[model samples]
Target: MTVNNIAATFLLGGIALSTQAQADFLRDGKATLGLKNFYFNNDSREGAAKPSKTEEWAQGFMLDYKSGYTDGVFGFGVDALGLLGVTLDGGKGRSVGSTMIPVGSDDRPVSQWGRLGLTGKVKVSRTELRYGTLLPRLPVLVANDGRLLPQTFEGGQVVSRELANVTFNGGRIEHATGRGSTDRTGLAAVGGQRESNQFNFAGADWRVSRDLLAQYYYGHLEDYYSQQFFGLVHTLEFSNDQSLKTDLRYFRTESSGKNSSGAAGYRISGYTKEGDGEIDNRTWSAAFIYSIGSHGVTAGYQSVSDGSNFTQLNQGGLEGKGAGGASLYLYTDRLTQSFTRAGERTAFGQYAYDFTALGVPGLKASMMYLRGDNIKTVSGDRLKEWERDFSLDYVVQSGALKGVGLGWRNGKSHSQAARNQDQNRVFLSYSIALF
Candidate 1:
């Protein structure tokens, strides 16, 4: 059945529940409206591309409503999401490839666009089952939210926390809607042109101790690839505000189904060891962070095996214009680039401070730098690249503007393997609660 039909069915079921059950559901519900104004700009320094620059301004709205589960052995609930985007400005010839704004057949930014989503859920004991629109943050599948509206998936997922210190998750995803587009499309890897309708994943996180946690996840994309991930996080506290955190992650991926058979449409993109599109990679990274009072410092290193670029569920190769944005659970997934090229090694560092310590509440700043070298190329050449990013944020803590947020981000990248560029983004946001 369609998602709308399912939502209507759930609503009808709720209407037939006992009066006390209905009261519990209505009493615990919540609703909110979020507003965001964003501006984006990018300048390409060393590319022959048509649009050497892209600049745009837009406004976004998100209306969210979530109902509580009824009081019963098996309770039911529903969630609805509404998203709308309005274009405030689009620099005529400079807005061609703006991934955050939707374009029309005239190759111009659209005046407005929007979409709606609904999810129906059920709960029993410590386990819950949800179907329809979902924004998952699992190790294997993370929903991207770097643009005006978040990328969403249509699927069913189950989460269980019945066992102490452990949480289990399993899901099957069928479709995805890109952040900048209103239409939904099938799933695919970064470079694959054809669609893979079935993506299955399962994972678990175990709290081994008060200071350490362990995680394992497995994912399979039919006719594409299969991947496994292992992670560990530990924190050592020296005092209340002084501590050290260690994070380690590893991923193993291999070609499967049509990809393994060397099919034409299922091949991945980017540099591969054998110049073939088949996926085979092992990636690992380690990071350490130290914090004392309001200051924080982080250092990390990452290495990608010599087979192919690290594989992930990226739909950038699809036929649509805005179907090209993805996120990775890696420290090197920075603002302008993701250091995941084949045979690449990256080292990165960052420093941050909380301004509240200086008597300026609700303000913070951070800067980060990353250098990557030994990137594989089809011409048998190694390349190097570097990036620096800066961010500043503030929130109103008093008066009529309390809870309003403002942020600015800037980054510069120089690369031997890709274009050299500079980018900036400014955003303002606020949320209003409705009972």
Candidate 2:
């Protein structure tokens, strides 16, 4: 059945049956649409000639509908999401890279594009089953939300919260769509394009204590990649006026499906065996942040051991896989020019302060820096790059724009192998809950 048909049927079933009994079975279901008047621009220090800069403005819309479940031992419900993008200004010289919207077969950008996704949900107590469109964020597999739009998946999922402090989730994703697309395609890891669909994953997160937690995740992409992760987070109090926080993360990845060289061409670059073959990637990182009132400081280090580059779906900077939106720990997934990959080592530090300590209610500022060395490059010397990020955020405490939020981002990236990059982004966002 079509996506619209399935979603419409579920919506009707819930409403029609409730109406027959004169009961408000679906009392709180409503449709919501949003518009983000977004402006984005990126420039590389290399100058003209080469494609170093991109700029655009567009209105992104997301129409979502959620329904109340039927009352019973087994409850049933459905949800639908409609995404659309309209270009306010974009053409040959004006259009940037793959930021706002994807280019079309015509060679230039399309006036607009959209997609429709529907999901059927079944619930039994705290355990829920969802089939159809999926958005996953487990360690091994994370959906991309880095563009004016978000990338999604097509699959089945089972999420259970049987334990009060523990959440268990597992799923199989067969297809994926880029943040800028509606059409679903087979699954593939970052920089992996051998056409291996089935992606299997399972994970559990335990809230060990009020301020401490642990997580374990495992994932496999048919013939492309296999990954596992372990993570820990904790916050410790030292005194009435001081505290220390730690966030530790680690991952081990190997070759799977087609990339195993069972049939497909020599697995894409650097993914072979540990040093001479394909697939042997392991990475770990730790970050510590200490906050005392409005003044906070943080430091982190990350290392990767693999011939091939580490990969993950990033929703910032770059719109593709393995990109980081904002990160100082080296693994930051900014999709900008390219995902940071290959022989790599990184160290970073950040500091943030709350204006409330300074007597200002809704003002905050932070700055961070990350430096990476020994990055793998096909050319000669290992690649080297670093970035510095500064952010200022403000919110109106009272009045019409009370909950409105404004954010600013400025960054610069320099690479020893490629051109330098500079970027600036300003975002204005607000949300209203209509009951």
Q: Write down the TM-score of every candidate.
A: 0.98, 0.87
Which 10 successive residues of model 2 have the least lDDT summed? Answer: 321-330
lDDT of 1 by residue, 171-222 (tens): 8999888888887889999989999989999999999999999999999999
Error of 1 at 132 (Å): 0.8
How many angstroms is residue 42 displaced in model 1 relative to the true structure, after the best TM-score fit?
1.4
Model 2 error, position 175 (Å): 1.9
Show how many residue pairs clash in every candidate, following the order shown.
0, 21
Q: Which runs of model 1 end up more than 4 angstroms from their true locations?
A: none
Q: Which sections of candidate 2 miss by over 4 Å? A: 1-9, 12-25, 47-50, 94-97, 239-241, 262-266, 269-277, 313-331, 334-340
* lDDT tens readout by residue for model 2, 130-234: 887777777777666656667777788999998899999998887666665545566555444455557788999999998899999888877666888899999
Q: State each model's CA lDDT, in order.
A: 0.90, 0.69
Best by TM-score: 1
